[model samples]
Target: MTVLILSVFVLVYLGMAIGRFPGLQIDRTGIALLGAVILALAGAIPGEALATAIDYPTLFILLGLMILSAQFELAGFYGWCAVRLAQAALSPVALLALVVAVGGGLSAVLANDVVVFAMTPLLCAGLVARGLDARPYLIALAGAANAGSAATIIGNPQNILIGQLGHLDFWPFLAACAVPAVLAMVCVFATVAFIWRGRLELADASPLPLSPPDLDLWHLKKALLATLVLLVFFATPLPQEEGVLAVAAAMLISRRFASRRMLGLVDWHLLVLFAALFVVTAALARTGLPAAMVATLANSGWAPDRLSVLAPLSLVASNTIGNVPAVLLLMQVWPSPPEGALYALAVLSTLSGNLLLLGSLANLIVVERAAASGVTLGFWEHAKCGVPMTLSSIALAIGWLWAMGHVGW
Candidate 1:
């Protein structure tokens, strides 16, 4: 049973790293789900234990947040912002700054992946129509989303998991991570601007019609109200999952928007991935391998709580198997980590995702949408800015973490 669980675990994570099974259409989500199912069939994890393995609160919070972000998407809020950014008569660098600012600010409160998904194509079309190279801008936008999403517990999926599992407070997390996030956004702007200096302008650009987004002011107002209410609850003693579900319930009561459409915008694949990975990791945890490994690592002075170990681990694992999966693996292995360590994990894993094009979901969304908009953003092009931006931002994050007494030697 132990060997079977280990084999399944290795295969699932390997599939995660490579993003698919060769000669098959199975993706990461499918792989994780299959692995969990295999373990259950093998009696590695019983049905009752399997049910207990999943963390429903994390899923509920994710669902609520996705609904909130979808309201903005459907109301044309993100599209309107993109149109505004495209029309801004600023210099290339100034526009880059604006892109980072907008992406970062919106992602700080909403889901970063959804923010990029809604804005990427619109922004790309506007830039390409203006005879400007859209690659740098697209890269900067992805970087900004990742960096900005590091600020709050509600910003991104991984942070939400960390906050929920760690039971981290809203304000202390902001205090610990906000500065690093801001600095990372600055790094995004600077790195992209510096790398794309000579290629900011295009001579023979294809012109396309940039249509305005369909605006629904009333629905937009409701989404804003829900967001405001959510923030207020965060400031209170209410459980985050309950607060999120309450707001999501209210969002479903809309007269203008259908609950089906709003729910459709949620990333159901990701939610399934989370549930599946929980089972996979829980099955492995039952084997005692993870706990034993943690004990050995701690005795050898390689505990994840230390900044040096966690920073590099986050960078490598996040870019490899992806940040969300990486976080789940770590949380499973190292249960009940220090509060500061949880903060470090959230911030570092998020910021390190800018190092490669496949680092974060937001980055991939930008790339795909850019391709649809006739703007090709290759891996090397992204890496030119990504490598430096991630390094500098990570350095700043480590420094801030040390200064705040979160992690140190």
Candidate 2:
């Protein structure tokens, strides 16, 4: 049974590594959910064990955040910010800076994937209108969102899981992770600007037709107020899950927008992936391979809590299976991880997402959206910016972690 479970696990994760099953159209989520179903039908996971394996709190928090982001989208707030950023009178370089700044800033508070989705088309269209190539802007947009989301617990799906499972304090996690995130955003801007220096703006570039997003002050104000209330709750003694749920509930019931409209925007597929991965990981753990692996690492003096050991591990894992799934797998072996290490994993895993086009969903989102506007960001084009930004950002995070330790943080 253990061998069978482990075999299924390996095959599923192999699918994850390749982004799909060969000769099959299954996505990562589909692959994962299928693996869970296979194990359950094979009696590899008992009913009682299945219940404990799925992390409900993490899922609830993630679902709530997704709904909250939906409210922002349905209300046109995200599109409004993008249009506003596009209207800035800044030069190409300065505009790139604003893209990184706003993209990263919004990601710190909202779902990073959603942030990229809402902002990419606007940036692409805006850049083309200004006779600028959308490649650099797209890289900056995606990279900044990934980096910035590392600053807060609610910033991304993986961070939310880490925060909930580790019982991390919201304020402290933000404080510890913010410095690295900010510096990473700078790294993103500098790297993109330098690489695409002369080619940043294309003088003869013709603007692509882009329909402007709708904006409503009424819905926007309501969503903003709910976000404010959520932030306040973060600073309170209330459970983060409760605070998020309360805010999400408020956003779901709007006077103008139907509840179905906002709710439909939620990433139900992603939630399915989380749940299915949880079951898969739990089954793997029960086979004792995870414990054995940890024991072997301990014997070799390797520790996930040590930045030196953990950073590279997280980078590879994140890039391979994607960050969210990588973190979920690592969590089982790294029970009660240290505060610094936890912060390191969260940021490093996120920062590593800028390594390649397929490194994170955010990167793919930007690329796909750019292609829709007739702006192609090929694999190498993204890597030209992604590789350097990833290296520099990870280095920055390591330095910050070291400095904080020295200062008794």
How do all models score by TM-score?
0.98, 0.96
Best by the lDDT measure: 1
Candidate 2 least-lDDT 10 residues: 202-211
- Backbone clash pairs for candidate 1 read none
Best by TM-score: 1
lDDT of 2 by residue, 339-386 (tens): 778888898899999998878889988888778878998999888889
Instruction: Write one digit per residue (lDDT tens) for candidate 1, span 119-235.
Output: 998998788777788888899899999999999999999999998888888999999999999999999998998888888865544444676687899989989999999987776
Q: Candidate 1, after superposition: displacement of residue 186 in Å?
A: 0.5
Model 2 lDDT, residue 270, Cα: 91
Per-residue error for 230 in candidate 1, Å, reads: 0.9
lDDT of 2 at 363: 90
Point out where model 1 deviates above 4 Å.
202-211
Predictions: Cα RMSD each: 1.5, 2.0
